[model samples]
Target: MTAAKLPAIGCEHPMAGIARRTHARVPPYAFYEGRKQDWRFSMADEVTLVGQEAEGLAARACRGAGATEPTTRSLVAATMSAALFGPPTLGFPHLVDYLDSFRDGRISTNPQPKLNRPFAAFFVSDADRGIAQLGFDQAFDQFVETVRHFGVAIFTQTNSYTAGELGYFVRRLAAEGIVGLAATNANAMVVAKPGGPAVYSTNPLAFGFPMGDGSPPMIIDQASSATAFVNIVAAASEGRSIPAGWAVDADGNDTEDPNLALKGALLAFGGRKGANVALMVEMMSAGLSGGPWSLDTPDFRSGDVSPGVGMTVIAMMPGVDQAARIARARTQADRLAGLGVFIPGVTGTSKKEQLTIPAGVHRRIAEFAANAPAAGNMSLA
Candidate 1:
């Protein structure tokens, strides 16, 4: 496969502005404060990059790691959004996983994603063992249009690398004034119950809906597990023990040692309730998409083959008087906030124009860029 020329590097996509405006109220630094030790970086060990520069660097890094231009563009946009508005771990840190997969042959550099419409309201995609974002990117316009026409649409994708940030999918729909619920599975690493074998991945689910009052869309994104897998990995890297009930040893005995937990399985967040949520996500994502179950998927971190996970996104148009309904919801949210209730996706405006990256993470990204082959010299085989 021949490499495509890189697109212009900038956060100029339609979602970029909406994400920035909606997430402006979030205090950017708060996400980084408490976990400095686990992340192995202090606030002082940080470098700031303008959004455009960060996106450019991310694109270069992806291209250097053998991704095609289109793949790089899709992944860079998602990465920047995650870094800017979503969880910090899912942003630049997660890009490292994609770069490694590209170099290790776990992900196709130039996958030819194929879309199928078996029904008027349902769309299916084969990612050809590439990143999940590209498949969604390709189907987005059509999916949104379908939702508008039919009042509801469902998109399912199979045979892709693990989704980097599940919230990214729904947030895009929320930007278009649609409600979106998205779910994706990874390799099996979570157990349904104490003393049970692993039967689920972290199995994240995300929901987003437009508020329509200049307030950011309300987004709720979380893993069904007690915590994210990345958090465990970070703890292990920092030689720290995790909280109790987070995981169990390979023998199904509860363990707080991150290393042991890595060898074992993560526990669900609310015991049976969280496990049920994981099961629900698995059914919609892996079951509905014809993708491999978590038990059957390969390890995303170690294998040369793709994990071949699945993602399902359901979009729904609001009811009659959509604008009025959305405004009412916003008013309710404000009233709840006044009662000291924690509202998801509502934060104070952030004034900073640039994003801060931990120096260590920035160095790793820089290395990928510095080592990338020249555009015409790339090999996609």
Candidate 2:
């Protein structure tokens, strides 16, 4: 595939005294043609393509990496995780470069700069993509263990794709009675406001605080932007318009057009307040973690590019009287429930909620897995 040139950068100046400045830049037009524009296909047909094309290439890379077993497992695990948390189209292909980087020794498994506090830092420098959660899960488990021993812990991961929902990583800590906050930075996709140059990456933030009872943890997850980039791509692939205020055109004008949004930038959700939070996330994920700033990150929507993103996980133990604290929180939740305010992630959801993959998608995944071994992939016991 030929590389698309970056559009020349220029911004339309706002009328005098308007206070809002827009970035004048055009998005790379052909960047998404392969996936978003030419996406019309039967589910089965798409699945076949994923199996025959995507998986076939992935299998070859795994063998070349010489870590076939772990790489194959990571690919399957990422695929399963994506299926569980939707936008399934977004996660798996990213693994191609990640596995290759691992084989090439571009990614380091060692933690950097030993810390006095319970902290660990990992840098996957080579635009590594998939298996963020693999590292995240291990880091979270270690963080939880460390927090249990030291009262708090922090885990920083830099240079990976978006890594799905931040809440998914911390909720595991909450299950063990630990409070957790997770954040990540992405490629520049969200602007501080309409008519503003894109400056942030939606910069998701999530918190999981245990409520003590057997009920689910109190989980809060959201992108600071009005919408996530993946969701924009999903809408574009489906030929659906996005909601107004979710994104802006190249001129920084608000637009509901998904195609324009893909080319433009997303708006912060709550205006300045959301942008402030996004800034905080950027600091924690990229600034402190030694990852590239969102503007420097490569676009993941286009084929196997490292997102150059970063993630931070903070885990802490509740106070000494954790039970009492939880009871107090439960009282507040009960009061809110009396007022018809459901405490999401706790009172309103079932832990047993089933994840159902469409037949075609599932079949395609199965076919890919089956073909992988014969195509140079390895199996785990």
Candidate 3:
């Protein structure tokens, strides 16, 4: 989630205005290649099955982050978490970096999830390629083929929800012309000690939208982080840093050096406000949904030492009229434009009801589900 404002530097221009103003400063091309590009997936008879498979993959990734060829479950679990954050049309670099971490292991394994469910995946990120796309190709056979063959490239969730819950929500929402989206966030969850340590990497915000199209309303899911930590790690290993404002040092200073920032903390978008939103996400992702919290826990940012965070899911039903919602949104947006370019969040009331946008998925090991590990559900000796 690239912020359009620069409050850190005392510059708070409108996002679109700023982008337009700066367009001439940069290249004259669309940054994304996947815009308007359809992410066609096999028409699986079991969208629910695919969703469950995605859920399994998310959980397994945290536990089985070390496998050379992780089980379908593991890969899906890891990838889903990451995918929920970026635009649905995420760039290849972002997706690859996120997936690579599963092989390395970054998720935690404590204070397990109390809930878990299948969610329809959808989003769009603002990446170099402009946006990332995800979809379930048509046909159940195609789904099986992809899972068994190319393997799911990425799996993303914005918040915590059981596979069944997510599946039900999306299916119904789509029927009602709304989009449904879900994602999660996690971190070591450390309480900052003033001039000492920084902690907590709350997950992203989960969004569920009722479709607005004859098909389904698109989802505009996201988080506040510029990129996943995996990308930062890759850059560091290759002797590089991030774009800017992605991180800050412990002493309240921003740094392009990923290593230094890693030693410090990931700053929230609007400082304390951003941190507050992060906290909301943390509570929703982990706290409200049942994951980890730094309020009274060890820091996970110190490297999987804490019990990890959970997720936050926002399901929006845009009613049964897709065209009306779009028209209303565009109208309201235009009205707001009468004042000036409306703020980013202002334009998307119904727009936010969408789930599939553009951009990016996959990730590392995490402790448990937003609910609980299914072990307790099984009969014990």
Candidate 3 Cα outliers beyond 4 Å, as residue runs:
1-176, 179-183, 189-196, 206-211, 214-218, 226-246, 250-259, 294-309, 320-327, 330-381
Candidate 1 residue lDDT tens string, 145-217: 9998999999999999988878889889988889999988877778899899988877888898788856778
Colliding pairs, model 1: 24-349, 24-350, 25-347, 25-348, 25-349
Ranking by TM-score: 1, 2, 3
Each model's lDDT: 0.77, 0.56, 0.34
Estimated TM-score for each candidate: 0.84, 0.67, 0.41
Count of residue pairs whose backbone atoms collide, per candidate: 5, 3, 112
User: Candidate 2, residues 31-124: lDDT per residue as tens digits?
Assistant: 1122232122122222223333444344444444444454454444554433333233333433433443444444322312222232242222
Distance from true location, Cα of 356 in model 2, Å? 1.7
lDDT of 1 at 38: 31
User: Considering every candidate listed, which one attains the maximal lDDT?
Assistant: 1
Number of the candidate with higher lDDT, 1 or 3: 1
Please write out the lDDT profile of model 3 over residues 1-381, one tens digit for every residue.
Answer: 111211122222222232333222111011122223212111111111133444443434333333222222323432443233223223222223233332323322111212122322211111111001111211122323332333221232222211211222233333444434444444332222223344544334434433234322333444444344434444455578776655665574667887765555544455566666656656555444444453433322122232232333333434345568755754654576588763332333321222321111221112222222343432211
Clashing pairs in 2: 10-24, 11-24, 22-195
Q: Which candidate leads the pack in TM-score? A: 1
- The order of the candidates by lDDT, greatest first, is 1, 2, 3
